[model samples]
Target: MGHRFELHKDVELAATPEQVWEAIATGPGIDSWFMGRSEIEPGEGGRTRLTMAGHVEEATITAWEPGKRFADRTEPGPDGTFTAMEYLIEGRDQGGAVLRLVQSGVLGDNWETEYEAMKVGWDMYLGTLAAYLAHFPGRTAAPVSAFRPGAGGPDAVWAAVTRAFGLAGPVAEGQSVRLAVDGLPPIEGVVDLAGLPTYVGVRTADGLYRFLYSGAERGDALVLGHHLFADDQDPARAERAWQEWVTALPIG
Candidate 1:
């Protein structure tokens, strides 16, 4: 065998072991967090394929214990390297569970280099999965900084903003709507806030908007603030324009 490399990671999920297991066992559930299409057969000798962005990795289940433990031996890659991946779900006294991922196998000459990169990538991806699972059914969208009465009602506010900064174009049914602003590049998306079912075009790159809508406030108000933007833009101008745009909207 060639030189071997092992990688292990653990994440404490705020979900029951069953919930975690469900997430791991089901295709949709696994896709939601693992960034792939995973097919997991439920018993020993089962196999799996984790496909992400068109890349696929094959694994064979060597062990399975329902909602508790799952292990697999991955097929070696072209470089003659492979991994034995395993997961252990331990129920905690507090009604949650701790999920640990362990990977051990053979590696080529640069094990340390690859290991370091894997460490960082796993930390970020697993952290994201944990957070997303914790906030299941929640939408992640643009942040909201302030909302105040405008000259017109919410409808008017919507119109003015849309008129000033029209939709980048019609988005696909399930895709996000991009907004076009003058002198600034288009923003990625607008999300529905609270009971507001329709997507609201809110700029979130400038940092002018610090707070996000959590479905709490009411009234036809012009919601505005620093939206997120590219660093190349003048921060002060972006903030000022964002504030001014909110004020210019018509309130009821």
Candidate 2:
């Protein structure tokens, strides 16, 4: 049986509606905060494509109202399961803007785990969005991503990640962290999101780094989603360094 679900989140950003709209509706805007690389065709009925680790998924834009609203839906699968996402942006009288997100979808079998993970995932991504607007406004990031396969479930993966990064117990927002992966340049930053068993985010002066635990049910273990804002950073080199570092982790 398929399970239907809807998740809603509202966040106030320190940016204008135009800025918020650009972040949510444009390709470069999404690449800076969300998972993978994205390309969006303008206006309603157009296509939105996201590519990650050589895999691609596309959705059709269902609604498009510049600076106000944008929505997209993926085609239903064989079991009639599909995902739809909508973003509503409203400019606030005091200056910034309020961004609301509604994500509705139907999930096949393992719905509970998937739904729970999705909930956490959105919260993390939205936080990244907020960070992007507040600190790195008007800049497009060079995205960096890598996956650690065959890592055990969430608990084991979280343990290993924290252990590697020297994080003890549950990390809190505002906590300072230093990442010293052997193959990559050292990263020193502050923790921005820390939802145990699901996500950990670190924000450095030049980047937003995300560590995600994909549940065991999905057959994938951990994912590193990072965005570098420094003009001299090479995304390809950074990605390779991360990939090598993750693949060498003592897991499973």
Candidate 3:
């Protein structure tokens, strides 16, 4: 990767180094907190791919050290794009672990906006990773994201969302919630995560619902990724329910 741009995030988690490594290195573990579906071919130069709602991103494994580090280097893009990603695991001085991600690459002209978005995305996903380890360790995640694009500004969208999902206030970890929407089935789960202002996740007996916010000039949108039970509870139906429900929302 060229030394044009770089984005890095370091997180201290309450899990061990082995646990952190497993969460980042394994396919199913990544599914728990990342894109809807992911598969990793272990070892240096192995290929890893992620698919969520038909969108795909792939990269070649660049570094591999069990319980210590894992990295990837993506192919060059048509627009002179370059990427080198790394996940480093270290034991914390306290009784926990620290997981760090360093992503560096060369960018075209519109790099600033993209870089900021990447930062937020990394913070959100890594926060989810920490939450998954804390709440649902040793479990594989099956995820499906229901997209609702062009929903408008965050304030209006968030209000509609709270009213629709029976969320009375800002989301936080470990809060109990009850679903109150149609088209989709009933959801009852503790707030597995609530990285509010953008990310909120609910882990239920059937699966997980990870809500994501997209803030852009074109129009902000929302995506709800139902993980670990996309098939368990009628995949098509759940997505349809969400699409229908979101369509019904008052778009601002």
TM-scores for candidates 1 onward, in order: 0.53, 0.93, 0.86
Scored by lDDT, model 2 comes in at 0.90
lDDT of 2 at 219: 68
Largest lDDT belongs to which candidate?
2
What's model 2's TM-score?
0.93
What order do candidates take by TM-score, descending? 2, 3, 1
On the 0 to 100 scale, the lDDT of residue 74 in model 1 is 79
Q: Rate the local accuracy (lDDT) of all candidates.
A: 0.55, 0.90, 0.77
Candidate 1 lDDT over residue span 1-252, tens digit each: 367767878899888887777766655556444433577776888888876434778888898887898788977778888888788999999777998998788876767655764665565446545644565522221222334543444444444554544443432222344554444566654332212222232323332122112122323344442323233556545545555555554433
List, residue by residue over 159-191, the lDDT tens digit for candidate 2. Answer: 778777777977789888887866567899998
- Kindly indicate the candidate among 2 and 3 with the higher TM-score: 2
Error of 2 at 34 (Å): 0.5
Q: Please provide, for model 3 over 107-210, each residue's C-alpha lDDT reduced to its tens digit, 9 standing for 90 to 100.
A: 76767766777887787787677777876766766555677888777878777766666667776677777875586667788777666567777777767677
lDDT of 3 at 70: 96
Off by over 4 Å in 1: 77-79, 137-252
Local distance difference test, candidate 1 = 0.55
